[model samples]
Target chain A: MHELTTTRNNYQIDPVLTVWGWEIPVYLFLGGMVAGMMIISGYFLFKGRQKEPTCSCFYVPWVSLILLSLGMFSLFLDLSHKVYVWRLYTTFKIASPMSWGAWILILVYPVIIANIFIRLPKFVTDKFPGLEKYSKMLTDRPRLIQNIGVANMILGALLGMYTGVLLSSLGARPLWNTSILWLLFLVSGLSGAAAFVHMVAKNIYERELLAKADNGFLTFEIFVIGLMFIGLATSTEVHQEAAQMLLSGSFAPVFWVFVVGIGIIIPLIIQLFAVNHKIQHTPVAPIMVIAGGLILRFVIVNAGQVSHYLNAHF
Target chain B: MARFAMVIDTKKCVGCMDCVVACKTENNVPEGYNRDWITQEAFGNFPNIQLEIRSERCNHCENSPCVSSCPTGASHYHDIGGVVLVNHDECIGCKACVASCPYDARFIHPDGYADKCTFCIHRVEKGDKPACVSVCPTNCMYFGDLEDPNSDVSKLLKSRKWHTLHPEAGTNPHVFYLT
Candidate 1:
């Protein structure tokens, strides 16, 4: 070229933009997984699958409370002004994902409690006979129980979508800017829930049923993730660079190897073989699915931070 | 209503980082954190390189993502001059704004709130310039009400060929750089 004169701004500052840490990703992962668990249990209740001894609907609510509480605790630790967190509930912001999530969580507690009450296990009734009346009333009213199941499904869907929307609405990170992120999160959440059920179910039929469900959800999750990447890549240069961060840049190895390879692909293949009876089912694949789900959130959250507009050399 | 804005002349910038120091001292930024910073772009090969030193900070965008991302309305646009400011008491340190800021301008102060360049609101409220603008040795920084056509920043924008940090992001940042 004729007298090459290139202009670039290479001076960089450390710790300039970074703020979030491990807490956020952990919160997101747990929240999505819990939402998935709620949906699975709700669907089972709606379908009257409670007759099965190993029905996930029996214990998912109780387990969800513990998991969600842990997630919330992690979130609480991230807040600088933990005492002022009540301010978030003082007002409802239609535009804020955090506000919506707060209200959804408030509603989720009652639904979860009702779910557990309606499907109280024998150990609980045996130990505390006094609580039998409430359980009896819930069990007696089939229509009312089904209605609660529907409510759980609706609320669970909202919670699942809200987790991803929380990050995507920020619009600052191109990797999170894609509209399909919420869908990917929802599908992944459902897959994790299915895998969780597959691992814990005592009934072989129920276990196989959940394993098959997990296979379907995992496939759908992969498709949604592909869409998310495509959506980002086809957008502006900044978004394209953001996609590259996951594709072949610094985050590629972890994303492809850990998240995609070890987390998803291997599990999907193994599960398919297990379902076809070509191989005996092991908890390894379902466990991998859960681990993959968690890693997916970590990769997305951290990679989004690395993908910035200014850092990209246009 | 006035719209506050800052314009930096890259040609005049020495990247001495006086602005960064002044901002930290004036704002009492926590240790290991900053409210403003500088970025240098050097291009070309060998001795024939073209270098551009940019003193950067929060763009204080007209369409601020931080404002919308904040659930408690802690990060808000000041009606007086369109300055993006965070109310520390109301902020829960959720870091939503920190993650959403395309400019990477915000940080979680040790005090447990999101903070960024406020354009020295305390000084500006007293009819004074921002600390960084007032302390620039090369006079490369200009801060004024863009709403006032006669203001220094407005005049500079009109007279100079300027570019914002990320026009593609569509945040409509108030900070402009004159090449």
Candidate 2:
């Protein structure tokens, strides 16, 4: 016979850091990626580059709908009262970022559909005679098509910035309470989208153009990230600690290895070399960019939760 | 037109966690989650150390980020005393309020909506004290309408030296701690 005993692990409960989880960062990643794709697609359409098979305008809207739906599904999974999700549209609270996001998404669907219509491939339009009439309406009015491109660009930019503004407005998490977060997220989205297009581009000229654009966006992203750190470090003590979470604390490894090293710098260096013909273009760089972009959101969301006003140290 | 608040006397607190237990029992707080809890902090070095015990919960802020961040008006102020309450029926469980709260007072209830201390409004409405206040062995917790000068909380504020958690966060918390 043996005496039975129970053992317990003595982990302190962090009361202030319990509300959010993994679903948030995944949703942010998907939302940002969709915004990026739309912007790329919009720009190509605005420039009247629909003839190229590799032009994002041809397939971006279809792809965007699928990606956005996936992102919304992730968000829906996070909700506790899934049946009550319809209540979000009952009325808009102007102060609420969540409200703005809901409305923006509603607006996004139609714009994406119109964009897809604008760039409808001939084979499909020929198959459906009714679709050709609508496609012709877009082709007949160059200004209408241009206005649609502008609308997508504006909507896409707003969607990208909203993802960051959503976090920054929290004010509770020092890591997220920065004005620079929106710019960083938007630029990251653009770069991510550019990398995605670069990978799938069938035309050499389009691929090269996107590669160059991604490189530019990457450089700007580095600057925005640096500015964010500087802004945080210069603020109150708690804000400094929040910034340190990325600079030297628990999140440092992820931020440096995944976000900065593999995500930004490696891809940047590869693209630079490829541009000079020192190396051939490979999917490796673009894939790394996409991975880094996703990791950036994860790091921000997770690390932001860990950063708070009062804890054991206080 | 009442503005309710809680004043906790840290000196009288024994860290026995009775208030925590009482709150859970009264509120039916889910397993592995808490509506209120205790936090212990040790200040100074080795021999000169001062140990502090705090009973922490939602401040029900006058400038609550959670309220403004809520998309569907699920998190709103009650009409009677400006108490922040959640309409679970309207909650989409987006967790915007959870992230926006600086004190980290709110949690996603297992039922899938944002939940937190209601200051025991159900009891307060019935002219009863909150469970934590009624059960505190050390008599450390004080609750009343801050707008009423006759209320015990207002008198205590007038007599004691008190501070709020994270004043710099600027939510202007209704909860106060007397050193």
Candidate 3:
């Protein structure tokens, strides 16, 4: 049989082509989750102990640490020469968002680690006196820790929003450049954070402990999802192209199945059942909501990057 | 002072990519890399078609987004003739400027520096035309000082109907293409 042949040029005909692959979306998801967790934890920390400090406060630091490390690792993997990536910090430039993000992560990581260490149980702390002393030092200076937490919150918020802005700044890539992308990213981040917390709580805590933790986060996530949809629908042509991909283009199946089906609608339906049954205090609904939120982040990040500017014209 | 510029006559261009090869050779552009290239838009399927071929390169814009986005001041417009050049020593290779360029003019070189068409600044400084202008078989590429009335580029600007890529970007690129 004669072979069907297609010749691909070494040269890219499209000027807007990018080498930014899976790393970009991974970075976005990680940044969103980190920002979300930091915000939720900061809110609870500043507002005093919630119904369950074990799940909301103590678990958040560990989860944030894991996500932050994973995201940073993925970022390194995205680089062409991953070994030389450390040089980015030495010759920093303020105009580059990546540079800004790199510095922010450096500052944020240690504080998160410190926060996590301090909140550990006395048995663990007593076994390691040096660690226990360090924990005590941070706890004794509550104001310093508070300031650190506030900075983390503000920086985390920017980190979350900046991922969208980073994409938006490429005005030529009509798929990315938009004023509303930042808000969409922020809402998604919060949703991802809520989902992550729900998952972690489900894995670690008993049924009684889960019931004590607030289920209100599900309602908040639904509201945010609605806002994200509205923002996507009303944006400009480039953004419309990206949004359309979610609705009907190559990204539609994933967007519909994962983001809408699993993340938004499923959680909403589950929460409705819980509320109607007067099971507002239950953990099952929030757990489902959180699963949906994680899946939403996965779908959006992958979908956003899959469609390129040149692809739109062709 | 003379403002350096290029004038391309699209009708004369055969889409041979001679200029693309000439540019890479002159610039020491890395293997599997390019400093300039051509794009073709063809309509109405094979055997009943019309084609438009355009040479593409960094425009050396008056308001270059690449320069603005470079966090380390590595990519900057030259003071002498407004040619954009990257300082290899200072570039962090974050590829921010690469992403910022509207025409996809810039690339992150293997040496971890942002690289693009410099309008052959070294040759221009030595009173020579860009290699692409000198090497083009059909005489499609013209380079000269835009400020001098006698210069070919300036005269062409006055005489021909021309356009630059992405005029809406307000970069006022030095390169002009005759349609």
State TM-scores per candidate: 0.92, 0.93, 0.81
lDDT of 3 by residue, B1-179 (tens): 76778899888888888888888899888876778888775656557776656677889888887877765677887887878898777666656676676666777777666788989899888888888888999998998878889999888889988888767656688889987
Q: Give lDDT: candidate 3, residue B122.
A: 91
Which of candidates 2 and 3 is the stronger one according to TM-score? Answer: 2
Model 1's CAPRI class is: acceptable
The runs of at least 3 residues in candidate 3 whose Cα sits more than 4 Å from the true structure, single-residue gaps closed, are: A1-18, A50-55, A83-87, A120-128, A137-148, A202-240, A275-314, B1-3, B28-32, B42-51, B88-93, B107-114, B147-150
- Quote the lDDT for B40 in model 2: 68
Candidate 2 segments exceeding 4 Å error: A1-19, A51-54, A122-128, A311-314, B46-48
Q: Supply candidate 2's per-residue lDDT for B83.
A: 92
Q: Distance (Å) between predicted and true CA of A35, model 3?
A: 0.7
Q: Enumerate the chain B TM-scores of all models.
A: 0.96, 0.97, 0.92
In model 2, what lDDT does residue A90 have? 93
Of the pair 1 and 3, which is ahead by TM-score? Answer: 1
lDDT of 1: 0.84
**lDDT of candidate 3 over A204-267, digit per residue (tens):** 4432322223234445545655665566567654556777776788767876776667666666
Query: In DockQ, how does model 2 score against the reference complex?
Result: 0.48
Q: Place model 3 in a CAPRI quality band.
A: acceptable
Model 1 C-alpha lDDT per residue in residues A209-298, reported as the tens digit of each score: 888999899888878878888888888887999899888898899889888888788999999999899999888998999999899998
